[model samples]
Target: MDASLEPRLDFVTCASPAGLHRMAYWEWGDPANDRVLLCVHGLTRTGRDFDTLARRLAGRYRVVCPDVVGRGRSDWLVNPAFYTVPQYVSDMVTLIARLRPGSLAWVGTSMGGLIGMALSGAGAFAKAMLAMRPHAGMLPPDQGIRLDKLVLNDVGPRLENGALSRIGQYVGDSSEFASFQDAVAAMRANSQTFGPHTDAQWADLAKYLYPEQGGKWVKHYDVAISQALSSQTAEELAAGEQILWRSYDAIDCPVLIVRGAQSDLLTRATVDEMLKRNPRARAHEVAGVGHAPTLIADDQVNPVADFLLA
Candidate 1:
């Protein structure tokens, strides 16, 4: 086994009256270092998604990546309705309380970015947040109006056609890799937009993939998360936007939004509005990418590292 950078890995649990139980995460870094970084994953992804990013950041920050409720190693909710942001926010609050830290930095992808937004507000946990290709208004509150600009991909207002099909594949797919290198190759193949990776980068990404009972390779995440996205209605989608806007306005911390140039999930108009609302927020658009920019390559990772390190 590879030597753990963290001496110990702690398993934690949190509960919400909404009847959701979330998993907590802690990776032991330098005992005396006070800086903590929280990396959250997108919908249908697990906490392991940050393996590469976290390992790279471990030297300077105690990186904590939580498997959001109903995903990865976390418990699933009985009520799919509870999959909304309110429930997610509540669970994250419990996580922040447990960490008991004075400040934090966040790296959030897609759905995860919205969660960071919820926490970056005046009373929330994060001191700064870097949001990548965030879902425009997948929440119940962000329906109607226009949610096409928050991200930079071709995802339709209503998830249908091959989009839904593509999502289902990752929600719980059947694929296997013979070795860690195999997994990395798959990730790189899937993430060609980010460009090439060194062997080390591939290994870093491989940590997130695992073999299944049937000996098939797949990501380490929960299958039920897809249900959460399926349950949202159009009205609910709009409501999610309202919540997002509120949280955006409430955020007092530094905010950076990195959008994929080819993404249909977030529209330019919406991003413009967000910038107007939060003058403190800045944005970066990655060319030749869609929906999200996996911060694996130097082009993607360097800017993020500089932002958080600065």
Candidate 2:
């Protein structure tokens, strides 16, 4: 990739119940642009995942991709229990305060989509929280935060149990590799659902996923981040599902749901229901993709670009 197309790496301190941790973000385009676009990664992915997409859309907006604490260059929480959406949402709000963008939009993949839903819905509450006492590392001006547009990549209000179980098995898998090739192969095998990519593309995807560190190729994200996910009971999941649905329904902004045609996660029925529930919502499906569509390809990126830019 060209150096000019690459994003500027930065970090922001965010408060957790345990303590403060730094959340890393990659910035692209003009810093002075008030129209902001936030691109958030998946369960075990990093902010770098958006490099290709960011390159395409950066001209129109100041694109900011966050590692979503516990992944990529962000700090891991002292307590694994803090690895939930609320904590992630809080951190993102802090990032927004730091950016102070006059306008905001969002693109979130999988787990990141859930955080977007939660945060986007809490616009009024977030405004009030920031006014009083919010965990933004530093107090920022009480400017209201709202998502003018949102792109939910392969996720929705309800998650499929079987699909989630399959994802859970791999999320915290503590597999170690002796060689970079071996680690890249492992990631490709594990993420087949992300759809087709060239060999070089796969290499690029794995670069941030399993950094060469401490004499071994290990996953970038903190494996302990899955603890809270594993302990969720059926009742808890059901309650969480309701909360997500409420959030989805409450969203006042236009939403675009991107689903892989072969996805086991976000179903067609759910997409249909989302459109029915939110009049401002629409859907787009990628051919032959599953679980999620890596928004690198033109086919996937173009539609999202149109939606966010429109």
Candidate 3:
């Protein structure tokens, strides 16, 4: 495929406690298209994770995938403590202001999904408040951009501690690879939770996972991001759950919950609970997967496309 025809890289300025930073994004399709689809990656993943999905949806919507702060090409926070959902939510709102689409939809994977839920629910208000303070006069008047649709990929309000622990076990363990192939091998081993993929697909994924510097390869993201997860106590997690559930219940947009049938993070019981609380929400479980479905495969992408384009 011609690289020129692929998504264009861009960046937007966002504010944090450490000061100002730039958040990088990749945009596909017509820039003037009012229909916007924002695809966010998982905790340690980059916007490139959505390459396949973005290509499939570009003709229908203006697809934008952002590398969250502390990850991908985005700036690493001076204070790793700022690597929390609230900060991420703030950065997204800034990105939305820059996009200024007529309508917006979201496709979020794992940590990305949590940000979506917050934006769709009471979390929007949190962002609004954040914009008003500190960054006052930087954002335009609230345009009331409704979150038209949402696709939560293998994540919900309730998170399994065991799964989180498993993720933390390797998140910040950055390493230099002897070669590109070795990096791909490491990525495949650590991301087995992303389910199966062909060698070609894994190679494509690895390209974005690591970037070469000083004649060697290194993980693309800032390792400090793992600090937020590692320091969380049980009480803090429970409190966070209450906040997230409130946000979930407050959401009014149509939500499509895509679950990996074998996922350890989001369970069937949680999906059931999510459905009960939100009349507009539904679930579609993908077989043979574990923590997440990358939406790279046709079967996985089809249902999401149907929901968004419907």
Candidate 4:
């Protein structure tokens, strides 16, 4: 089966204090299949980042990849402040309601992994806070779907300040390129941490990174997403880290932590702590990668598939 041919575009309306916005998604495989796998992209990426992985998994699961709000084809938030994890989590809750799957699995890279950790590990108080929102009325009657398996790609509760600072420096840079090749070169330079990919793979990845507009190739996401990172102070990040640890501990499902061997974002110390906290959590280190491991390669995707299928 042609995975590209199998995917269909769809949208879900999600609510925010600023109002409602449409979140776009790509669905692959049998829509009727109750076993669902959700693949969410990194901080600056769109849903299309998972095209290769989604295609491979489509035969066994209904794969859904959403362009998180303010990225890809998803509508930008009326309030840039709403680009934080809480809002992302709320939007995902809305999406899950629409999918209504019997069993759910998650693959989250970078910021996406943070969102998954929030949803999968939220405690009673966190759930109550989410439910108290005005849009809570729109959530599924069961609240939200529980994850059966979770793949967190190069992110953990504890983050390296230096790595975050480096990411923050470039997260909002939206330079225009004269040609597609130029854009590809820029992406390759900035994303060397995503590890090595062939010239063909980099070309494929560039398609989603740059969207042509008015005859110029521009970055695919809304620039305001950077505000979410810029507004976070060190103290706030520390507090947030505490919250993430609580949530990570609350998770009952099997967890897979995909760490790029050279990652500066998720440190070996943090991975060790995570495993200590959750006995069910295991680590898979992708050699040569830095901040993240894009699940485009068979070596990266196979371990994830085996974990989910096991």
TM-score of each: 0.72, 0.92, 0.92, 0.94
Give candidate 2 regions above 4 Å deviation.
Answer: 1-4, 123-144
| Candidate 1, residue 256: how far the Cα is off, in Å | 0.9
lDDT of each: 0.59, 0.86, 0.86, 0.86
Cα lDDT for residue 5, candidate 2: 60
Question: CA shift at 162, candidate 2, in angstroms?
Answer: 0.5
lDDT of 2 at 263: 94
* Candidate 4 lDDT for residue 309: 82
List residue ranges in candidate 4 displaced over 4 A. 3-6, 124-144
| Tens digit of per-residue lDDT, candidate 4, span 60-176 | 999999999998889998889788777888899889989999999999999999889888865532654454444433222223348999999999989899998999888889799
- Give the TM-score comparing model 2 with the true structure, all chains together: 0.92
Whole-model lDDT, model 2: 0.86
Off by over 4 Å in 1: 1-8, 18-28, 122-210
The true-versus-predicted C-alpha distance at residue 30 of model 3, in Å, is: 0.4
Ten-residue region with minimum lDDT total, candidate 3: 136-145
